[model samples]
Target: MVVALARKKIYEEIADIILSEIKSGKLKPGDKLPAITKMAESYQVSQASIREALNSLKVLDVIHVKHGQGSFINEQMPLGFEQNFEIITKADIANLLDLRKIIEVGCVRAACEKAEAHHHERMAEALGKMWTAVENNELGEQADYDFHMAIAVSTGNPLLANLLEDVSETMIRTMKETRRIWLYETEKSIQKIYDEHKLIFEAIKNEDAEAAAKSMYDHLKGVEDVLLTNY
Candidate 1:
């Protein structure tokens, strides 16, 4: 059983407790997590807090949620997942977004040419999930990350896919942070971000490499601008 958490940073503390359980082998990979209500009771926090904790874990690729089912530990967790949660400075985030712009812009161009039907299906599925999350007032960070990863996979370049996977933990963290800024600190709506992603997906679907690259560059640059200005 998890211990009750203090009021301060309650959701983050709950996430850490769950992580400790996973690291201790008490919650093995593929194990189904307790129901949100059960977790809230165990942690002495609200169900909203429990959901937030699970969402953070999901963004980090430590867990995966099945709609209408429950969350589960990811079958393949990121390497050194526990160590990757170190504090990230704003400068670090800015630099990381810059690197993403360089990498993802090129990846989308290749995806426009190489993406197969199934790859497009995966991107569409991710976009659908993002829309659902947005409508439900959730961060939808995992779906956002999945959309980008689908683009990388669509590139048909294993090295590019693997490179993105290697840095995924940090990438998801920044995504969540940026989305939080957009949702809470600014006038931008999550719906607008979803629309930007749809524009990228449309370009890729149409097999327009130049358009896809430009869309991706514009999307990432927009994110970078908002992140740096607000965070």
Candidate 2:
């Protein structure tokens, strides 16, 4: 009994360390975690101890298992139109979308409330880069990612920034869904986003806290409308 209790303590502590690293993006999605033996050695514990902790994470859906491939981080899940139509059950995707709506909106609002002019400038730059990438027909995905993440960083709240990491594949799913509409709209929705984001940036630049918050809220609401109506 004493040994069992000790092992549990060791496992939980090590688990916390690994989880924190992943949350900080030091261990990103699809990164293969160290083998059980390596982790055991790193933590100065028995292999059984590390395995037990990894097992717990697996149950929590924080990691994935493969028979011959070894353990790795689970990539974000897809809630995009493609996923809705062909990847998985719509019901599961619906629940996932609802969760993302709550989390990201809350984070963006918090970021808007706290960010500064320089942050807005940086965000604007990211948007410009995204547009350039789009015109080039290259993947503007990372630019889109950076703009939102810059806001999260500006929030002065690491939790808001870390939210994406903990959300697993939900982040990927959201981008996939949002981008699908953008890729095939009648009007240049890209320009529309460029304008909306410019307004958001200007609001932040001018220190219009209420306006910034409301603009972000409204923008996200529009995203929800698109996802619901189209997909």
TM-scores for every candidate against the unseen true structure: 0.64, 0.52
lDDT of 2 at 217: 65
Give the clashing residue pairs of candidate 1, or none: none
lDDT of 2 by residue, 1-231 (tens): 355443436767766676777777898889898888888888889997787677545534466666567778868622231121212223444565576556655655665577777777778889898778667755465676677778777888887778756654454455544554566443445555556666767776676767766776676666666655544
C-alpha displacement of 25 in model 2, angstroms?
35
Model number with the top lDDT? 1
Q: What is the lDDT, from 0 to 100, of the residue 98 in candidate 2? A: 72
Off by over 4 Å in 2: 1-113, 116-118, 137-139, 185-188
RMSD of 2: 13.5
How many backbone clashes are present in model 1?
A: 0
Provide the clashing-pair count of each candidate structure.
0, 2
